[model samples]
Structure formats: C-alpha cells, structure tokens
Target: MYARKPVIVLLGLAVCGGLGCAQPPACREGQVATPVSAQRHPVAGHHLRAHAHNDYEHERPLFDALDHRFYSVEADIFLNGGKLAVSHRNLPWDSKRSLEELYLEPLQARVDATGSVHGDGVPFTLWIDLKEGGREIVDTLHAVLEKYPMLTRVDGDEVLPGPVTVVLTGDDKAKRDLVTRHSQRRAVRDSNDYSPEDPPADSAWGYYALRWGDYLDASSTGQLDASQRARLACIIENAHAQGRKVRFFDAPDHPDAWRVALEFGVDFLGTDDLRSLDTFLDGAP
Candidate 1:
C-alpha cells in the first residue's frame, strides 16, 4: 500500500495535465515573487480557418482539433428523415452523430469553455457544408439553430444564445439562393458553375468556399487554371467589393497550397490538419 500511494499521486498529475491544468506557482512565506507574464497565444486572423472535413468520421472526432486550439472546424451534414445527421453521404447517416450532437453541441461547449471571441468581439464561425438536397435540411437546421440563441446572423452582429457564427455550404446555388431569399441567415456559394454576375442583389454570401475541383494543378503548386484563375480573381474582387471574404478548400494540405493561397490574398485556406496550417501561417519554411 505504501508503494501504491506514490503511483496514485503520479496518475493524478497525468490526468490533470491531460485536462489542461497548469502547475501551481511557488511561494515563500506569505509573500510570492512577481509572476512571469503569460505567453500570448497567436490570433488566427483572416488567414486560414482550419477545416476538419467530415470530422465525425475521424477516430477521435472534433476533440482532436479542439484540443489543439483550432480556430475553425468543418462538419458535413445530410438530412435523413426529420433529423439533421452528420455524415458525408446520405445513405449511411448515423443517428448517434446528429449535426447538433457532433458539431453544434461540442462547439457550443467549447465556446462556453473558452469564453474566447474573435477580436474578443466577433463570434466564431461554424462552417456547415450540406451534403443532401431539399428545403427539409435547411428547415431542420433553422429549427435547431432557433433553440440556440447564442448563434445569430452575421449581418445583425447581435449576441445570440450561443457564440457560433453559422455559414451554410452546398453545391446547389439555386437552393441556397432560395434559403437566403426567405431567411435572414448568411450562406456561402460553394459552386464552380456560379459567378459574381449571377449573385443576388442582397447576396447573403459572406464568403466563397472553393473546392478541390475548382483548382488546376500547376508544376509544383495547386492553382486555378489561367481562365479559372482570372475568373476567380474577378469573383473575389467583386465579392470583396460587397464586403465579403473568399475561402478555398480541397487543395493540397501542405505548404504548397498555403503559399499559393497567401500569395493570392485569399481570406481563408481550409485544411484537415489544423496544426500544420497553423504552423505554416506562423512562417514555417
């Protein structure tokens, strides 16, 4: 029992460390020495929001990126029956990992846990890429969102019941347009077929999410082909003209894509590996 006592104490310390506890400050008598300044963590600005595509499929789920302090995360959603399920495909949607359970719930917990805000002012963006078609999913999501007041439309900038900023992503431009027209919520155009000219007058597009199919392969880097690049540049310029940002995804998950995206002045580069993207943005060469 005597030897076992030390083992128990060590185990407790390990558990504490895993839960993000810091060591206690040393002191002398009743007075303590001046404490060192807390190290300032880097702020992820409009550079690249780390995206965990189909995060629910990962063995560890969203916790891995959250534990590493990822600024943004992505979860694909599909409408199965009346529930908003979290999955890449509609055929095998898991009831256990609903959109609320896998994405919104954990995210809400994080915002509650951190109490951190953008610029200590803006709400954190939760990018939801929809996989299935129909107004049913949108309605279901809207209903779920209504329950959580912290989430508000970015246009209003009001503090809702939650601190998450929800952005919808989908391939169906017409459907997305219909949702935006009826509701006041914000949505992004994630299609290669659509252009700025066709954008709605009161475009709810706060950001443009480009996929892997949208880019062309360069010698050693990923880029939009000549015509595609020109068109994208124009779209981005026009989008910015309307106070919107541009984001790209499905590109190489390495320094190559990061370098190109930065050079092109993209607002966000989506990646599955948050740590790598974070490091690259921090000037990893």
Candidate 2:
C-alpha cells in the first residue's frame, strides 16, 4: 500500500507536486564560508515540521525518530498495574515498555546532554495518545512527567517553555481534566477538533489534531482534488489564526499527501516513513 520509490521529487529531487515543476536553481560553486564561532548542532538542518506517528512501533522507538531529526513524536499508552505501558492495544501483560523507559527517559537524557533535544533549544513535542484508563492513566502520566524538569511547565497564565512539551491526546475527559483541573502541569492537551467557530487556544489547548478522513473524501481515483486542497488550506488557516498548530493523524503516509500538507502550511506532517518524509521535506522549499 506504500510507494517504494519516492514521489514528489522528480529530476534532481526537485518537488513541484501538482504545481508546475520548475528547475532547481543553479549552484554557485566554491562559495564556502565559515563563521568565527563554530558550533555544531546534531540536527542543524532538521525539519521542524516532521512528526513521527506511532513512533514506538519503530524498531528503535524515540531514538529512531530523533536520529531522523523529527521534531514531534507520538506514543500510545495504556494503564497496566498502575504503570503507563506503551502500546496501541490493551495487552498490558504482553507489553513491558513503559512510557518513561521508551520516551521520557531517553528524551531527558538528550536534553541533559545537549541542553535541548537537538542542541538548539527548540521546543520538541512528545505526543502521548491515551489508549485506556482515562483519568487514572493521565494522572499516572502527570506524575511521571513531573519528575523530569526538561518538560515544559505552566504556572497560572505563564508558560515556561522547556526543552520538551508533552501534549496529551485521546481520552477527552482525562485531557480536559488535566487542563482545567490542574493550575500547574508538565503537560497540555491537544484539541481533537478544529472548528472555526471554536474559541482560541488557551494553556490547555496548544495543538489541533484532526483525523485525515474526517474532512474530505478522496475522488474516485483516491486522490485529493482541488476542492479538498482548498478546504485543507482553510482548515490550516483557521488553526493558525486560533494560535494553535495543526497536524492530521491517519493522513496518507506518502509524498503526494505530504506535498499538499506542506502546500497548505500544516504545522506537522505525521508519517510512518520517517526517512522518506525527511527527504521529501528536505527537498521542499
């Protein structure tokens, strides 16, 4: 179901998508320049918009995504024996990976080593999708997150941005409780809906995560048409205006879908093919 060969990029890996393909600019040779104060960041040219969906499913989990320079990563967790076990299903006994072990610990280590996830102090997002246990699981997560000082914190109306920001998705009531109930929390909630009529973002709601199929149906040929493109643009525009970043879950995990997302200025593009998306975004303007 996935395209093995990379799309979007044509000759010289120049991506035009549906738009007219334009030749890449001529390269100016031998214009190398160096700054007086030299410093190397691990992900110097990282794509700030790349999101690793179901990151834990990968062989290396969080590390794999970081190696590819992904700015955002998602892990699905379920409550098991009062511990947050990372998995997509409710098999607690079968899963031994804890959220702390899989994501939080490694992230904290990276922050400690580089003063940030990528040595750039840019806020990285750790999106936790609650699979079950509702309030119990969320509370457990909050406790675990609090132990890590690298996570972003909120005191009243002030947001202290740290190296990592935890955004909780799924379990609507639990997420709302985390936002409304706690005055000080290490994590925030992700807005599942993106309605133009909805109120602006607050401390609780920092991102808009919509399902791909909820908005538009692909044409008979299973591709987005002009109308879909326009609607997507409007959705992203509305999200941006509301001071909330936008990302679509379960979106088409390929270059064609990625092109439309980039064209519409989607804040984060979720993909299982990390390397392909990284390469595609790298080649994009």
Candidate 3:
C-alpha cells in the first residue's frame, strides 16, 4: 500500500459562472439524486472513531491515519496556481503537495482495493479545511471532487453514504456555497459554529466541530468537574439528537481528554498522536 505512486493533477483554466463548473449534475430544487450506500461494498475491519487532526502534517498524510485504522482525518488546503494544495499555511513549497495526490487518489485507491476504506461499512471522513474562501476555490474543489464517486454525496437534502465522506471546513462561505450552488455533490460541510439552540442537522452541515475551551472549563489536570461534565454531556446529547456527529478539536491532546470524550460518547476524538490514540483506543473498554 505504501508503494502506490502519486497522481498529480495538472493545473487548468478555472472558469467560474453558474453552477460553478462542477461536473456533477445538480438536482433541481426539491429533487433527489441517486443514492449510493457504503454498506453495499462492506468488507470487515476494526473501524475506530479516531480523527487525525492536521493529518497532512504527518509523514504519510492519509495513509498514516488509515494504518492506525482511524475513521476520520483532516487536511487544510489553499488554492495555489489554480490547483488545490494541502497545507495549513500558504507556503510556496506546499504547492507541490496537491490535495489529489496526497489525499484524494490514495483514498480512491483504498476504496477500490478493500471495497471501502476499512470495509467495515463505517463511514470514513476526509475533512478538507479551506484556508481561503472564494468562488474559484469552491468551484475548483467541487470540480476536483466530481472525479471521485467514493465520497458520500448530497442529493438535494438527502445523503448518499459512500465509502468516504468529504467534509468542508474553515471558510464558512465556501462551505455554504458548496451546498447552495450545487444540488448534487460529493462533499458536505463541517460547522464549528453550531450551538445547542441551532436548527437540526441539514444535508449540508454534517458534523459539529467544537472547541474544547469554548464549552468545557477544564484545568491543567484534565479533570472535568461535575458542571463541566454536565455541560459536555448536554452538548453531545444535543448534537446527537439533531443527527450531527460531534468532534472537539483544540482540546488537550492527552489520554485524560481522550477518556472524557470517549466516556461522553463524543463521535470523533481529535488527536495528532495517531499511534498513541490507536493504542489507547485498542486498550480501551
């Protein structure tokens, strides 16, 4: 698996207009596109809800997370010379790392090889954080994603679960445009701005990524007091009841935090320490 060659996307002229050049057909308002289910291609493997935060920073990007059997992974990207490059910053050197080469194609290859990323029917998430927002960037991403049908898709308001689910993060406008502009797409949006009072999960906003400090007041000891625990549990329950998977990022990246998140039924536990998290989850009850 490690021996697979990279598939780089050659830069092309980015034309922007109505429907934004995404090749996938858009459904009319109130229409539903075809449904694709991941269960249809089920294979068997231990699928963990671990999320590799800033996964592109790792030595192997998506592969490292998959090696650890992590079901979720995140990558930050920016538009570089008409191509989407994976990086947290707009460093010129980062342009060499195309999103397609680093993450998309490898995931496509995995889906083809194992029927699904893990063959366990548990949806894998590829979180793409857009460093900047614009029609060109959003259009380019949708255009690129149109090539991969392995992604979980949105047909009107319905979700067609596929082997992998691509969630757009970072720029709020770009994420919204992805859903509003296109009626059919291979990706959904990830909202960190969600509140307990917010409306139920729509087809576009699939996950809630909360900042730990924003909701929980934990000390350096990593212990959650009774009130903090209550708050955390309330937030998780509220999000789950609305049909949105929850993830807490910018949290203490240690066993203490991980334990609390697991105990509270937090859906995707964010961590940069992939191997440690894998071992921890394996040893966990």
Candidate 4:
C-alpha cells in the first residue's frame, strides 16, 4: 500500500521503436498514502491475475512474487554486450542480474523441477521489459527460450499450453522483431490501448494494456460513473472477443480501485504490493 510505488507506467499507449516516452503517468486521487507493513503475509493460494510490476526492485525479485504465488512478474532488461542485463537504469547495471541468471535459468530450473505445466502447477508469466535491443539480442533470447518447452508457444494456428509464458514490453522494435522472427515462439508482445471498434491487428499481440487514468475521469468518490464503467466494460469485452487479455496498469493502488477493476473483468492486476493484493484476491471464492 506504499504510495511511493506509484503506477509509473500507464500501459494504454503502445510503445514502439524505442523507450522514448517519458510522459509522467496520470494519477487519480482518493488514495491515502499508507505505508506497507514490514511484516510479511503468508501465502494463502494462487492469484492468477496478480502481476508483480517492477518485480526486480523487490528484495527477492522473482522469488518474492513467486512466494505469494503471483501468476506474473515483470523485469526490466538491457541488452549489453550481447548479454541481457536486468536493471532499472543503465548506470548501475549488475552482471549478476543478467536475464539468464536472474530470470531465464531460474525459470527453467523451476520448470525442470516440476512435473506440471509450470513448476508450481499454474501458468506463470515472465514479463521482460527490454530497455534497449537489436536483432541479435532477440535472436539470442529466442534461442535461450527454446530450452524451455514448458512455456506456452504459438505454432501456426495453434497455441500449445505451457507452464510459463513470456511477454515482451517497453521497447517496441524488439517486440516486433521477436514476433516477426519467431512466429511460433513462447513469447508475445504486450501492446497499447485498443477498442473493440478498432480493427484488430495480427495475432502477435497477446494483451491489450492501457492506463486507466487516461480513460476514466473518476471523482474522489472512489467509484466509476455508470458511463465510465460501461466504457471500460466495452473495452474489456472487445479485447476478450479478440482473444486478448486486458490489463490497466496506472490505476491507483487501493482497495476501491482494485474492486472496480475486478468488477470490470480486468484480466490482470498491475501491482507492486504483492502481499496486499494476494490477500485481497485470496479472500475471493
């Protein structure tokens, strides 16, 4: 519930070419700045929609989110010297946090250790936000991802079930390149806001992500107006109709905000508060 971890990324806009957009994310009021308790909460069960935004920033990166049984976790990566290095910024890139070391290898280990689809028996999403890229980098990653057949994959008209799914965000060029090079890959592109009325793109994209602050004009009441709710519902419906999951990233991190998202049938909950969100969803039947 710590307000400092603001929804910095409003996923509504499709990012492409490069990491050029630095527009500050839109914010909604009515969120009280409450400090997240240091006391850790025990895992209750799996939260399929829970996504750990900027998970690498946590003390345990993927492990922390995994402990809570979060279905998805995000990591920011920079392709440096033919190696994908995981870091939030360039100046302090740590070689020890390379994507292979931190995410890929660990994920493969988990998959190998398990007899189920995912190591833990549920689908896990590893969101890789590339800070920079080139064709070779995508090629390298494609090769690396090949070892894990347990990851969901797209083969022509069919999609095979896998334990883990890889999603590429942030840099748009690399995303397009990845899909173009490997049409039948375990990874998919995470793209911007789209409406049902809009003509659908190719099947390369897997999710329609948006920043809620851009669409809804909510008041301090902590509820969306009927018209607002209807608008959101239509977007969700349209995305689902297109076989795409819908995620809104920049919504306020509050119980009311979460309740509204759940009611609107949001497919993913963008959160940094893994424990709090899991606690909230854990109570759901």
Per-model TM-score versus the true fold: 0.67, 0.81, 0.82, 0.78
Alpha carbon lDDT at 252, candidate 1: 62
All candidates: CA RMSD (Å)? 19.6, 11.1, 14.8, 8.9
- Residues 171-235, candidate 1, lDDT per residue (tens digit)? 46544753565455433334433344444324344566665433332333454344334444554
Best by lDDT: 3
Question: Please, what are the lDDT tens digits per residue for candidate 2 over residues 1-285?
Answer: 212221253553334346453322212232222112112224543378889999999999988898888989999988888888888986745434888888899899989999999888777999998876466776787788889999999877778999999998987888888777778999888877666566787877888788765554443222566545545656666666678888887776778777766666777878998899889877775
Clashing pairs in 3: 43-119
Name the runs in model 1 displaced over 4 angstroms: 1-42, 45-48, 91-93, 117-122, 154-162, 171-178, 181-203, 212-217, 223-235
Query: What is the C-alpha lDDT profile of model 4 across 1-285, one tens digit per residue?
Result: 212211223464322224443322222222122212112223324277788888998899888888877878888887676677788886555677888788777787787888442454667788888777788778877887787777788775567767788888877899889988787787888786564455554457887667665555454423666545655666666666567877776677776766776766677777888889889887753
Compared with the true structure, what per-residue lDDT tens digits does model 3 show for residues 1-285? 011122222232122233233111112233322221112113222235689999999988888888888888999999988899999888785544899999889889888988788765666889999989999999999999999989988899998989889988888889889888998999888787656566788888878877665555565535676645655766776667688888877888888887787777777778889988888777665
Q: Which TM-score value belongs to model 4? A: 0.78
After TM-score superposition, the amount by which residue 130's alpha carbon in candidate 2 deviates from its true location, in angstroms, is 0.7
* Error of model 4, residue 231, in angstroms: 1.1
Best by TM-score: 3
Q: Of models 2 and 3, which has the larger lDDT?
A: 3
Query: What lDDT score is found at residue 50 in candidate 4?
Result: 82
Q: Which is the winner by TM-score between candidate 1 and candidate 4?
A: 4
Candidate 3 least-lDDT 10 residues: 1-10
Model 1: lowest-lDDT 10 consecutive positions: 1-10
